[model samples]
Target: MTDHIDGALALSWMNTFTEDFHAAQQALTDLDRQAGDGDFGTNIASALRKVVAELPTADDATFASVFTATANGFLATGGTSGPLFGMWFRAVSRSTATEGTDTDLLAQGVAAGLAKVQTLGGASVGDNTMIDALAPASQALLDASTGGLTVDKALTSAARAARAGAASTADLLAARGRASYVGDLALGVEDPGAVTVAIFFEAGAAALSA
Candidate 1:
C-alpha cells in the first residue's frame, strides 16, 4: 500500500517482466505466426532477458537508472519494435525520474510510455496492437492514482484493463503494424503485442501486490 516505488520495487518490476516474458514466449510466438512474423516472441524475450541481466548492476540502482539502462539496451536493437519499445522505456524512466517520489510515479511512467508508443507507432486504441492493452492500462493507472488508490489496487486495476483490452483484439482486424497486412486473417487472433503488454501489467501488479 506504500506510495513509493523505490529502487527495490523497480528492480522487482523488471524481474517480474522478465519472468512473464519467459512464460509467454511460446504463446506469443504462436500468436505472431497467426498474423505476422513469428519472431515477436523470441525477439522480445531476448531483449527482456538482456535487460534482466544488465540493468540491476548499475552503480546507483535507482528506479531511474534501471529503466534507463533498459531503454539504452533495447535502443541498440534493429527493426521497428526495438526502437519503439526502447523509447517507451525511456519515457517511463524520464517520467518517474521527473516525478521523484510522488505517489503517482508509476502511473505517470506508464502513461508516458504509452504516449511514446502511440507517437512512434501511429496506432490508436482499437488497432489490434500493443496500444490496445497499453492505452487502457495507462488510463486505469492514472485514474487509480488520481483517486488516491494504493499501489496494489492501482496496478491490479490496470492489469485487469490490460487483459480485457488484449482479449478484445481477438475480434478486430489488424489496423496497424505487420499484422495489418493480414487484414481479415488477423481476426479471431489476439495480437501478440497486445498480449505482451497484458503480461507486463499482470506481472507488475503481481510483483507490487506480493
Candidate 2:
C-alpha cells in the first residue's frame, strides 16, 4: 500500500488542483454567461487562490488541518460557492486527517465531502447542480475500491464519472441555485457548478497519482 505521502507532494497537488479549478471556472463562466451570472469563473478562481495560499507548510500537518485551513480560507473569500466548497473541504479534513496518502482514506474523505454537498445543497442526483457531478464521482470511487482498484485508478474513475455527470447536466433542467430562475432557459447548457466539481475530482486524482 502507498503510505506516507510527502508533504511537498501534497502541496504540489493542491497547487495543481487550484489551477485546474481556475480553468474549469473559466469554462463555466463561458457557458453560464448566456443566461446566468458571468462571474462564476472569477468567484471560483478567487476562492481557490486563497485556498492554495493558505495551505499549511509543515510536514506534520494533518489532512484535517490542511482541509480546515482550506475551508477557512475559502470561506473568508465570500461567494455563493464559498460556503459550499468550504463545507466540502471541511468534510474532507475530518475524514482523512489520520490516513495521509492512504487511498482508502482519500476515497472516504471524498464520499464524506459529497454527502455534505448533498445535505447542504439539498439537491439530489440529476438536480442540475454540483451534486450531479459529485454523487457519481463518489459512487465510482467507492465501487472502484470494492473492486480492488488502486488509488490512482480509483481517482481516474472518479474523474471520469465527474466529467460524465457534468456533461449530463447539459440535458438537465435547472432545479436549484441561480440557474433555477431561468427554468427551461437552463437546458442544453452545462452547469458551472457541475463542471467545477469535475475539476475538483480531476485535480485531486492527479495530486494523489503524482
Candidate 3:
C-alpha cells in the first residue's frame, strides 16, 4: 500500500471530490435552503470547478501545489464559508509545503487546517459549522498517524469521523455561520459546510484506496 500522497494522488482526490460534490449539489443546496442563504451548493461547486481547471498536470503535481491551487480557488469565491475554506486549505498547503507528503504529514496538514479554521471562524466542534466535521476528521487522522496506518486506511478513518460529525450537526442548533441566522429553523437540517468536509475526506479515502 502507498504510504504517502503525491501531487497525482492529491489531484485524484480533488477530482473525486468534485464528482461527488456534483452528485450531491442539489441535496446540499436544499440543506442550505433550510438554514442559510441557500447558495452553499452553487458557490462551492463553482470553487471546485475552478480548482479542477487550475490543477497542475499529474507529471508536474505536488501535494502543496494542488492544495495551494484549491485554496486559491476557494479564496476567489465570494462568501463567508468560501474564504474560510480557502484559509483552511491554505494552512493545509503550508503544512505540506514540499513536493511530497506522507500520511503523517497529511495528518499534520489536516490538523493545521482545522486550527486555522477554528481560529479564523471562532467556531468549535458543535458550532454547526464545517469545523464540526473538520475537527473530528483531524483528530481521526492524528490517531491513524499515531497508529502508523497507511494513507488509505488513515483517510478512511478520517472520513468516517467526519461523516459522524456532519450527521451530528443535524441535531445541533447553529452557534455560528449562516445557519445561526435561522435559529431553530436549522435544527433538523445538517450543516452544508460540515457535510462538505465529510465529502472531502471521503474523496481522499476513495482516491487513496483506489
Candidate 4:
C-alpha cells in the first residue's frame, strides 16, 4: 500500500520489475548472447527470486533491510553482473537509515549505490554497463529531490532517463566486464545490464505512482 519510494515501495517495485523481466527474459538472453555469456536474464531473474524470498513483508521491512536483502540476493547469484549489482545494493543499504518518506534519503542511497558501482566496476557513463542507465536515473532522482517534487514524479523522471540511457548504449563499445571481450562487436545492441536497470526504474516509477 505504499505510494512512494519507501521500503514498502521498494518491495512493490521488485515484484513489478521481476514480472517485467520475465516478460523480456528472452530478449535479454538474446542481447547477452551478443556481448556476454548469454546468461544475464537467467542470473537477474534468479537473483530477484532469491531477493523476494529473503526480504521481509513490506510492513516489516526497513529501507536498510530492503537493500540488504537485495544485495545479499544478488551476491548469491552467479555472474559478473551479480557482484557488481551486489556492491551497488550494499552501498545503498549502508547509506539508508530506518526512516521512511524522505526523498532526500532515497536520493542519497541511490547516489551511494552509483558510487559503489563505479568504484567496483571502474565504469562511468557510456561504459556500456549498468552504470550508463543508473547514472542518468540517479541524476534525475537527485534533481527531483532537490526540486521538492513527489516521489512518483521523481521516479517517472528516473525511468525516462534510464530508458534513454539504455537506448544510447546501443552504439557504445563495451568498455567493461564480460561485454568488453566482444569489443566493437557489441555495437547496435543495447547493453543488457542497462536495459535491466531501465526496467527497474520503470517498475519503481509505476510502484510509486500506484
Please give the ranking of all candidate structures by TM-score, highest first, separated by commas. 3, 1, 4, 2
Indicate whether candidate 1 or candidate 3 has the larger lDDT. 3
TM-score of each: 0.92, 0.88, 0.96, 0.92
Best by TM-score: 3
All predictions: root-mean-square deviation over Cα? 1.9, 2.2, 1.2, 2.0
Q: Once model 2 is optimally superposed onto the true structure by TM-score, how far is the C-alpha of residue 44 displaced, in angstroms?
A: 1.2
Tens digit of per-residue lDDT, candidate 2, span 1-210: 334334554666567778777656656788878547777778777787777677887675666666777888767766677788888877766655345645566678778888887888899987788888988988897897688777667777999999999999999888888888888888899988888888877886787766
Q: Give me the runs in candidate 4 sitting further than 4 Å from their true place.
A: 1-4, 94-101
Model 4 lDDT-worst window of ten: 1-10
Residue range 1-210, candidate 4, lDDT tens digits: 332456777778778887998999999999999988899999988998898899979778776777789899999998888888888888767655555545666678788889888887899997889989999999998998889877778888889999999999999998887888988888998999999999988988887777
Query: How far off is residue 63 in model 1, in Å?
Result: 1.0
Model 1 clash count equals 0
Indicate whether candidate 1 or candidate 2 has the larger lDDT.
1
Q: Which stretches of candidate 3 lie over 4 Å from their true place?
A: 97-99
Instruction: Indicate the TM-score of model 1.
Output: 0.92
Global lDDT of model 2: 0.76
Q: Which candidate would rank higher by TM-score, 1 or 3?
A: 3
lDDT for each residue of candidate 3 in 117-209, tens digit (9 for 90 to 100)? 788889998889998899999999899999999888999999999999999999999999788998988998999999999999999999998
- Worst lDDT window (10 residues) for model 1? 94-103
